[model samples]
Target: MTLFDSERPYKYIMDTSSILSQKPGETHTRLVYKSQWERIEEYMRSHSIVTCSEIFEEIKDKEIKEWIFSQQCTVLEIDDDIQNNVRKIVTENPKMIEFTGKSGTSSGDAFLIATAMKYGLIIITEENKDKQMKIPQISKKYGITSVNITSLCEMEQWKF
Candidate 1:
């Protein structure tokens, strides 16, 4: 049996952190039998995972990019609404300077969250939920639902 049903009701907007965290595949680092890999691949195809153009640019790993392409992850086009939301978040909360090039941290975080807000998609990231000025903290402040990869698997009852 495979997992790509295409009728699933949720869309996940992945962050670069989650992309880096997932690597080539969840079980690829381990010994994934061919069938298992196929099943996992099907699961990945079952849902729509999207990210903004900025988040796409943040990823430098070629293999990860290939995998993202294979998974059919949607790279959404950024427009005025998304960009303005990010600017508003940064302007209203200077403490989120870390997301605004503070210490050279890419403003990709703001862009990712802003994309989620504009599209009403759930945020998927591996960032520490307790850290200040990070995705989770800022997401909470804005009432956006943020989750980790593990939580996503759990939500789908995916043992993988």
Candidate 2:
């Protein structure tokens, strides 16, 4: 079953995995290599797509980072409400947060989910739903809809 409703003008909160995914065949990476960035740019400009600020820290590609910044998408700040929601998620599922081999744990996944919870938006993530301790699974557990990049293209009927 599809994660999203058959509604017009869908809005989404993107996870870092979705943004940086490089799935083989008809994926964003291939699209970008084919000089189809304009299509994606147009789509992003037209859609109500946003992401958490932590995506910046999670994304390792400098070019993609610059591209995202240039797209002018709404970068949701981790305010008190989002922080509280993240805490709740972490408390309930301690395994959701991963250690980044740094001083603190990686909060991108939690923050992305929390942002979606706060805004009541669907989550766009490349994480497999079958995998444990992943965004899709955790999102499903929390009653949130999560779809992959390919699903997003299909749902939106992007003719590319």
Candidate 3:
């Protein structure tokens, strides 16, 4: 089912890097950083969410994985449909696809983009890189919106 099929319709796709940045008890400023996963948990309860297996692997910390599992987030698998779609994206965007060779196409970033495109969902990331190698570029190319974690928190009025 598509993301929009849900009653609330999940508006963001969580990436592994974003998840990592949200670890509880992690220090940022003088205070311990609050878990963004908590925000995600609430979102999932009201809307549809999607993530990749690669993201799960990236969160190797047992604590984080267990938290993710407890949240019951949907784990997207690499099936023929996603594979074919990735192939098409690579073929269509040759310049961007080249970066996949060095950094690898099986990256969680690539999977996030492909899944967002397939399910028509927006991407939420913490990266500020403006280069074409970034997921924001791919999201722009596919007409999908992406925002940083801070912006997302602001949008939801979630204060840390």
| Per-model CA lDDT versus the true structure | 0.73, 0.74, 0.67
Q: After superposition, how far is residue 91 of candidate 1 from its true place, in Å?
A: 0.7
Clashing residue pairs, backbone N/CA/C < 3 A, model 1: none
Please provide, for model 3 over 1-160, each residue's C-alpha lDDT reduced to its tens digit, 9 standing for 90 to 100. 6554555465677886676675544322213444655566777555555567766775668977887778777777777777776776777766554544563343566667787877777787765548676777777887888877677778778875
Q: Which ten residues in a row have the lowest lDDT in candidate 2?
A: 1-10
**Which regions in candidate 2 have their CA more than 4 angstroms from the true location?**
1-10, 22-27, 31-39, 100-105
Task: Tell me the alpha-carbon RMSD of every candidate.
Answer: 6.1, 5.7, 3.9
Assess candidate 2 and give its TM-score to the true structure: 0.80
Candidate with top TM-score is 2
- Indicate the residue-level lDDT of 12 in model 2: 86
Clashes of 2: 0
TM-score of each: 0.77, 0.80, 0.74
Residue clash pairs of candidate 2: none
Task: Give the Cα RMSD of candidate 1.
Answer: 6.1
> Could you give candidate 2's per-residue lDDT for residues 1-160 as a string of tens digits?
1345334233788877767654345346754544344555665666578788887678877877887888876677898988998999999989777675763345788888887887777898877789878888888878889998777777877666
lDDT by residue for model 1 (33-73), tens: 44433443564476466778898888888987888789776
